[model samples]
Target: MSDDLIPGDESSAADAADAVYRELLERLGEAQPQPRLGATKRALELLGNPESSFAIIQIAGTNGKTSTARMIESILRAHGLRTGLFTSPHLVRFTERIGIDGERISDEAVARNWDDIKPYLAMVDAELTAAGEPALTFFEALTVLGFACFGDAPVDVAVVEVGMGGAWDSTNAADAEVAVFTPIDLDHVQRLGKTIAEIARTKAGIIKPGAQVVSAAQHPDARQAIVDAAAAVDDPAVFEGEEFALVQDAVAVGGQLITVRGRAGTYPELYLPLYGDHQGRNATLAIAAVEAFLGGATQPIAEDVLAEGLTEVASPGRLQLIGTEPTVLVDAAHNPHGAASLVAALGSYFDVDEIAFVVGILQDKDAAGILTTLAPAASGFFFTQSESERAIPAEELSRLAASLDLPASTFADTLDEAAEDARRWAEEAPRRLVVITGSITLVGEAIEVADDREWKATA
Candidate 1:
């Protein structure tokens, strides 16, 4: 065999990145998803515990974790600090999970880091194997990789969104300085818990001793659970309604204008370039978390910095409008709670008379509940699935919609076809909208299709 055939061959950076990504995919395919912390903690330990090199803000919740995390990262970066963001379930590319200074990690960086850490990862894998535990899952490995990348970047702060329940999640291995919860509800019941209280309790585990815990206004039971958790740890807990709130919000052109009452002071007329009162609340929570992280509520961020941060922030696939003419929007609202938020946003933001919804949901989600919540806003439905193994069949989803007395049609083929059909239906009726939603995977696929068709309108 030639020298080039050796593992340390003279491959281009892109080629090396591709090789590393392929190996990651292989590991991802074999992932067993054992929701435990041992594997990840061990891996981090083997890698010299890169997660401890920087301060961390861990955001956990059912629906808005990613959006909130993104907002926090943007705000912190606006403060002129080098920030690292680690979020899960990337919409299109794996690189989306790790960002430094508001940019996705470069392929060369990923490859270089992976190459540097491969031996350590292998050592951890062998240790786990010898201990009779399964190897690190996809998320676990990715979490370690993200921490390593962030350490190599030498970021001042890292904003992390929990992949699953906060306590045992792979990312939880990092001791977060600030733990933020955004409107926890019933989600991942099979893994988290069956009740809102149970889920909140699981999420509240992210609260470390002396950590400043920030939570959105939650249901009474959920609130109690989080409060109890914080009390147990002797941490200072701040709740939205009691400590901070969206004082005023109005639908604005492009997005929404709002006033927020933070722990220290009130900021008014902040324009967040994102739709929905829910998003407004998310922004408030992010602001509060950042305040707590930088200083307690008494220290407010510079007014100019806060305004620039909110203005520059963007949450793609969360009530995002990707097209015009016959307006096409996409949202990743898979659960009933998220669906309710989507429905509210649709009613409050857009003036369309009707909406043709192209929905695809995972098998585990409450498809009926989602359809029920969205039924009032939808004129018709085109049921489709994403390129996910867990996606429910289009016919099955249509049947579910029909049972709810919703007008439904099946597009079992592809998101592109489903979108085209929805667009045509919307065009047939003036002032109508076309929406692709229900599953994040579906929204990601639809976004790809929209980009390919040049359907995305420039701002």
Candidate 2:
């Protein structure tokens, strides 16, 4: 291998970080989050409760949680706060899940922190075993490690995205000062609950006794659940379409222009370089979240700070263009709601008619709902799978697609090959594009493939 691919010392650090991730995988995966935080809290307590060392803003929802968390982190950083951001299901490296000041936490940092926390975690594991309970799952351990990393960095604030439904997700142990909810819908039905109300109620558990609550527009059932949760704590949750809203948004070059009516003030004429009208709502929710965090939504953020934050905001793997001359876009739109937003963004942001989607869905996801949502705008489907063991097989996906009367393409040994074939088909016609979607795991693998192949975007 060339030194360009793996330089001596730097490559060693990355390999070490990868080793840390592998050790985490040896535990139970995040597919089934444990319904209790006692294990996580016990581990943290042994480490002096590092999560309590910094102020936290925790986000929970079925969709847009990671994007909204990034926005809040960026704005807080723009305001001169040393910020720590933790999002889920990294699109490239495990380090991407934890960030210090908008940059991925370094490989060396991840390795060092994991080493420091291993002993404390082992103690917690023994305690759980003795009590006849399961040890901490992958996400639970990772949350502890992430918070320890942030506390050691001594950040001014930390923005965290829940790994799953909020109530018992390990990050909930942090007791975030601001509880932010993105749109809640049917997701993780097996683990969370069967209906939207059940899921939303599970999510609202992040709202503690005195935490400020900020929410995006939600289904009536979802909204009521959050309202009830907040009232129980004597906290009035500020919501979009009510106290705050995405007042205006128009398609702009490379992104969109937006105006938001926040609880404390009105932010007009903002340039947010993220696709979808959904992103505009995510931005408004983020603004309100920061408002509540800094000054209880009673003082407006300075216009320049807000402008800088929005201008620099980025939501990768969400309508992100990875190539040109054929036009390949990757979006982590695994569920029906996110799929609907992707279709809308394509209609509004780009001049594409037919899309050949290189798709892969997880084992337990709502494949029918997601594919059905995309079927109306799709020309063909290139069924594929990621390295994730949870990914549904390409042949199985092909069978599902055929049953839906959607055209299916041949499978490939790898996602990169599938994307290449889809892009080739797209390049043969005018105003056609290739989209890679359905799972974050697939998008993450596609990103690595894109980087390796140097798929530069001319547009």
| TM per prediction | 0.95, 0.96
Best by TM-score: 2
Please report the candidate that would top lDDT against the real structure.
2
lDDT by residue for model 1 over 233-344, one digit each (tens)? Answer: 8999999999999999998999999999998788899999999989999999999999999998779888898999999999989988888878999999999999999999
Off by over 4 Å in 1: 1-15, 28-32, 457-459
Estimate the Cα RMSD of every predicted model relative to the unseen true structure: 2.9, 3.0
Q: Candidate 2: misplaced stretches above 4 Å? A: 1-8, 407-409, 457-459
lDDT of 1: 0.87
Candidate 2 lDDT, tens digit per residue, 39-149? 999999999999888999999999999999989998999999999999998888788899999898988778888989999999999999999988888999999999999
Candidate 1's displacement at residue 283, Å, is 0.5
State how far residue 33 of model 1 sits from its true place (Å).
Answer: 2.5
- Would you list the C-alpha lDDT of every candidate in the order shown? 0.87, 0.90
Pairs clashing within candidate 2: none
Model 1's C-alpha root-mean-square deviation from the true structure amounts to 2.9
